[model samples]
Target: MWENKIRCPCSRCSNNKFLCEDKVTEHILNRGFTGAYTIWSLHGEHDVGQSLRSRDRVEPYASNKEHEEYGEPIYDEEIENPYSRMVKDAMGPEVAFNYGCENESRLQRLYMSCKTAEYMTWHVQNQSDDGVLKHPIDGEEILSRLNSLPDLPFGTKCGDQKISGYGVSHNWVKNSILWDLPYWHMLFIRHNLDVMHIEHNVFENIFNTMMDVKGMTKDNLKARQDLKVSCKRPELELMKNNGKIFKLKAAYTLNKEEIKKICAWVKQMRFPDGFASNISRCINEIDYKFYRMKSHDCHIFLQRLLLIVFHDMVPHSIWDAITGISHFFRDLCTTEILVDHMEALQGKICETICKLEKIFPSGFFDSMEHLPIHLPYEAKFGGPIQYRWMYPFERFLQHLKKKVKNRASVEGSICEAYIIEEISSFSSWYFEPAMRTRLNRMPRNDDGGDVDSQGRLSIFIHFGRAFGPLEKSRFLDEDEFYAAELYVLMNSEEMLPYIKMFDEIIKGDVVHISEDELEKVRDARFVKWFKNYVATRMDEIDPRILEISHGPGRMIMSRPDTPLEPVTTVVVS
Candidate 1:
């Protein structure tokens, strides 16, 4: 009979050391039992079983149990003797504990234990070999060598079948080496060659296919010859200037007669629309006159005409007359002082007109029957004259005296008086203490009425008093005093019959007045006398254009009383 098994006499197995020595020896020899079994058995069966169950659950999910269990200790075993107590002590605790757990566990636990052992053995072997492993070869090299051939020539066949060269082929050409082969055969062959060892012969069939030539063919030679000949033609030719083709030509040719005719045509043209056409004609005339006379004064006059036409005309006439004049003068004259002056005057006039429009109240001039004052004075002095007893009474009395002397003078004198009263009224209104306070509260340069300059105030006063009552004695004659009064009457009555003619000339609507009525109105003594006076002074008020055409006179006085200086002569023999 087999002796009952006994634990080994080592310190770890001492608790179960009751068996025969032969049985223990047999167990160590046959079962490969280690000295740590005794200590492993000290853990209770329930504890060991629970540990094994826990390990069985963990092993399937563990990534690195083998490395954790054996890897580091295995390396330590190489440094220390495997049989030494210090080595066993270090390795035994963990191994014995694992073995106890494994023995009590189920088959699933055993499988994981075996897998861990196998993986640990592999890791150890790899570590021992320093990581260089050999790979096996199959028939890959034969396939590679078979793919290392050049492309076949175009229209060539290998044995009985067609081969592709540059493109896919459906039929075989006789004498081709790569008949019925896919295009990949040539790609593989080219790609497999060593860079330094590749031969020109390898690409000979490809070159032949590209050239559409076969059997030891020359490639691209005809193309190269054509390119060389094309290059030589450019060097052999002479270049000419092509710039003259792009230049613009002159518009028209004009001789002296043609130019003079053009000038006359422009001058004779009628404008019936006031001075617009006349201004343009003058500009053109001045331009032609400049070319004929070569005078700076003619050019200056042309510039002035251009400014007048441009500044005054409406859109319809401006384009036809003014803009045309400006363009013509721009071509002729280099200097333009007259144009500058006209432009400045236009700006000043527009500004003055705007100021007048704002200052004067509407209907200010419609009926100044209570006073004979100018419209400007009505704005500036209307309030002051109404409040002042002396001025308004004097004005009313003057109007009455003028009316009694000549019934025609009544309307004009009363109108002037009314205008003066209104202007005086406006001045007194502006100068009131409340109004002055309001004006002072405004900003320094604000639009409120704060008269800063004494000169400007004087001008305002002058403007206000322009049509106010003056001493009757100051007039040269009663006709002179009633000049404006007669004008008002004539504009209202005598100018009516020629209304259509005036409208045609002025390009405005006409109001009808009979000729007989105009004659009757003109028969008034003051009207007749004023007309004669104006006629006599017309030359003084108007400039004579013809006089300026001649040279200005030089004053020469004879001084016969003084002796003239004698001429000295040098004697040359």
Candidate 2:
């Protein structure tokens, strides 16, 4: 196939011929190129078959080939700590911090103003005819209202002034940087009730109740049910087979006395692998335990670990409500941002709130902890919940805070370290094979040294960038393969020598990026599938330009699905 494309130097067709597209293909191929890749295999370049990227990356390399590529890193870690390769559990929260820096940037201040405006607007618009707020108040608002003229949030509250039928709990909003921003008057964005804060408050409410902590216990305990009959499980085939009915024991319940006993019990309780030690410590500290527990500790305890704890405790309806809310949030945090999905997520949150209302007395929700109900609309209309999530910024703060090594001049230390990191990160991009990733080293090919899977020096463009003509040359990491496929498709060539030799075909879909082309696809299901398929496969497939066929079934071309990129992976709970 390559030989036929070469222009004949013998001159029979030289002067009349234009030396078309075939000539270039012929020249590159027939020029006696040393082609080790003329043959190929789906089994891959592994000695016994595996990609150069190490398998069992989290544990240890699975075989010699994997060990050759990646074992050194694991070995180095083990040299420092013998158990490094084993699964290690974290004792505390890692994703976010309980507190953030007091200082705010000008941009942050602008966002705060927008937030304040939006919050005030939403409440004003939703206020009832009776002059009461339709929903619960928040901490910031309470702080603002209670503040004196000389206090941080001045003018918001005077001595005994009330707001939305509630008295302020404190006097401090001076830390609210937005109060002085120029755009404060024009802002109309919702005050972002951070999900982390909402979750923390809810957990505290439940925890305080569970321990029957002094001044924190509620008469209408949401999780209490010692005197009532609860829902029963349906009779199953086990009872039918025995020709007898087996009764279930009453569901667990606790009173003030029982809770106090459990609090003592908790001091001696030993949790399994996943729990933090905070659960046990809270036992003796119930009087003011809220002061010790950080937001994330409370968050994890209530959202994930509480379900197991409740099995041995009470059958309070409030506990069920809290569990429902926790489950909804778990879904909210991880769900992909499809419009339909977002709407459904919002619906679920609303339902959870309704359930909360049913379980708790009205006054129980009259605090800022209830502010999260308003967040769903914002999340649905705006984007994925992560876009509004605090964890990323909170996690970054962990990195930023670490940069400060000197106490004498903490700000200077942080600034200098930050500048140094910026310079180093920028300098890294100019290196021979720039590492755009967080990985400290380059990828391994089949060789002992860094290279592409094909054993060539790999030129990776971090997060993709464009260069060269024909558009496809700017790659999604397989330019050569992409170009070859395009060449075969557009050129009317019978088959390329490489293809004929290997008898192989690439096994993935091609997505045309044109909006016009996508609009032709009208089937919602196919569009959704195609989108999700593309989203999930971007890392695996050759992601350059065009040419598409969907096996004649999938594709309705208008729209679809980011964590790097969000799909439907649920939080395991």
Candidate 3:
């Protein structure tokens, strides 16, 4: 069995405790049930006997030619690894994705399952132990010891592929579909290590560091010193002119007063409606206020709630690092984002994490160390991080469990629920969707009529960030609609003829508008908005690559007359 990473047991396996598709279906089909739900009739299953039966006449059917016919050996060394050729020939190169398994025993067992090995493999006169790379491989030539043989009796049916296993038992070939191995391995990469686990652990470490829990509060003298120096203000007006730079104890971690102040600040700040009432639920459930937050308060505290509570009590670097990591993950989870952009964001994020090390107690880095290594790999896999994440699956599992109305046979209840749900969904595809999906209800007199399903558009007509939203989009202006049509045409590289066609269509218009004039107006408006946004929120801009005006009138103003973090005029010529 594979190593399960998440806390979930059922997410990795099923009610029958089966993780591997091959094993579970085979076991079920062997029961000889001829029902519609039997393994032979399972449409979702690729490896069922019925599915494989049709593929026997295919051109790429499993080749059984001897190793001598190909003139290429599976193993490099002739004397050792003799069974490697026989194993490859039996397994077939089509299934070469998991030709190398993470567990050497499984790979060995696979080899041992083959009946073609004529030479001595494992346990050859006690020269060495069975072949395994227990330690990290670095500068070693002596990997060839031997593969362990299977404990199964010699003449069992599937002990050899030649007997029947190919088309009679499985479709999709004997290829390793485990973890997208073919895609990653050929590119010199292994399967993606689940990033959700790494992120949760890292966030947990950050939360623990802030909470200043036991065992972690030990004197990390260098970390303390580094944090103190980084956090130290250049001067304090309250401290007299005689005041000198000095280290503060518990500089990296918050003290009691600071926690109280943070709580006071959070309480004072206005929040969304019912937020105050909702927070009361936390205290009522946990028996403690946010001021007295506990160390064991899970990943959500670090991921979401921390931003609301954190204030000036902590150093800006520590705050930025925490927020930066949170932002990085949130960005990765977005479906519309490009992979190249994410990889770029990952680099900037790594820099923030490196800065975070300065604030941690010297050896406290080991607490969340694997995070940086894992960050780069997540970008390699296509689509959003949520597709690879366990959170959504874990949440949906609760929904699935809720579908089980009967305690006696939960699986059967779930199947019944799923079939009902599937039938409803399929019916919705052909019928009136608004009635079946959005609900059959009378619209309010005040509500807009015949609204588009994809929500309200901006003032600029058809322009919108996403294809769909909470409210229906409307075409508010004719010019804006044409402008949007032009925009799409330009993006598709067919704008020239469209512009000519538009010019031809608007023959009898009372007011004449040229294509070039419309483009010029749109471009100017876009540039204006871009400049204004940059001017107001330069600090919030990612990577902060904008050049500050350190030229004339850029005096470093101090005190009441001139507010700190001076807002200067940006000259964009």
Candidate 4:
């Protein structure tokens, strides 16, 4: 197939170009063989496939060429771990952390397979240079530092020395394991901040400081003491009351009554299915402190609920600052990121941080607060925050933790359960779509799966289902019936045409029907007129429209689906 000219397996060429035998030899001598290319699969060497499902398969033979070039592998028996053994003997078999150097050969793994090699250098290959901080490579600080690496030794003390006036240099504590790779310094994003935990930490700091939670809050006696040295705010200054120290309320913090109001609101709040965890579970109405809120809980609070809950409760300046920070996060973590918008976000985040700094005590401005300034830049390159966040990894860790059945052999039990799960997941691919598999499984609140396509209007095709046990059922009264029916007809997309027809009829009767009055009239008469209108077009319209036109049944079933003590789900029969 090659016509005696084989692909050059050099590090630079990476088996990408066909070269004569002499050229191939020359390239290999100049650039070394492509990393981990021992198999020679492209050069007529067959690769042995090993199924993850089977454990009895014979181990593939290691090439003698590899043995000749790299030397024999080091066995555990040859390398002694006296320190580890001594620790095990003293500590009763405690697990010792592995502090080992990065394997030089492992760098090959990134370029070993052609499938992944291209993606490994994607930032370099597909770099955008239109002055947008659209990728890790565009992060000015990191890009410049990485590109203009100092000539000093990787882990030398010289890299840690203090500059003339600036504090001691903390750039390189120790050489990173990644520095073993020749191209490590060239890569734009060597590490990513877990936005999940950063947001969670930032939220905790804000919530704790604002609520004035004892012990947990950043605004404690020490912070107040520091404030005495840091700021000129006399209201927040510490007071000596009969030898007992007291700190006055900062303008940013909620008073006891305000905290109570916010707590009561949260205590009675409810969320839809799959939106967020039970936030009310963490709310303490008595203490006015949220307890046991997880990362995801904080995520929901910071992004969706912070501004709503704090509205009108705090002073305007405080509220505006909180709103700015809250909005910064909401925009930062969205599913789609626009580069142009990200630049605007850069300014917004800086302004938000500045606003926060003006309101919050010095203690509140931790590294996490500073971290947001870099986030928009990271988002420009990294794309959506979801892919880089720890939510999925943390959830998977929880899943792995659940898999441990044997206390004595935690790893073994987890491995066994994991393999079984993988097998089941793999097997599910072949299962019929109608059958329940992980992929086709319905949510707890699924409204009975698409409702039969035939003889159904699009409005009826999609609707919510109440999941909790029914709490109450009552028939609607005259006023309730009028309001309920109007709400249904007004909201239904399928009923929009009938609503327009009714509007025209109203316009014909009343020469000047203002939009506001027309809306009111529509709300008053649309339900009854829609029924008669749908009746006239019953021959052409779907039967569902007629059913909805008559309005929902008076029997309303209210159910509390969430942890919050509120009636969230209403089913009108």
Maximum-lDDT candidate: 4
RMSD of each: 49.0, 32.1, 25.2, 19.1
Worst 10 residues of 4 by lDDT: 153-162
Model 1 stretches with alpha carbons more than 4 Å out: 1-242, 245-261, 264-573
Query: What lDDT score is found at residue 18 in candidate 3?
Result: 29
Model 3: per-residue lDDT, tens digit, 62-132?
A: 33243456765545674534335535665765743555655324323444422223222322222322221
For model 2, state the Cα shift of residue 492 in Å.
45
Show model 3 residue runs off by greater than 4 Å.
1-171, 175-184, 187-189, 193-195, 214-249, 264-280, 283-308, 366-368, 438-573
Instruction: List TM-score per model, in order.
Output: 0.13, 0.36, 0.39, 0.60
Whole-model alpha-carbon lDDT for candidate 2: 0.46
lDDT of 4 at 121: 54
lDDT of each: 0.34, 0.46, 0.45, 0.74
lDDT of 2 by residue, 1-573 (tens): 133333322224432334444564465455543334322221122242344334446344254557687654334442233222212332333465657554323223322333233443443355333222222232223324334233332122122122332334543234457766544543334366677777777777766655545566442323233113332323211132367543222222245565565556555555433334445654444442334676667767776766655655665665676677777667656544344555575677777788765544343464654576666555544445565668688978889889889989989998999998888865554444443543346433112433345422122212221122221112223443333333333333322332332222121232433445433332122323434455666665443311131211121121111111112111100
Number of clashes recorded per candidate = 31, 10, 5, 3
lDDT of 1 by residue, 285-341 (tens): 543521222122233334443334223222343223333333333432222123233
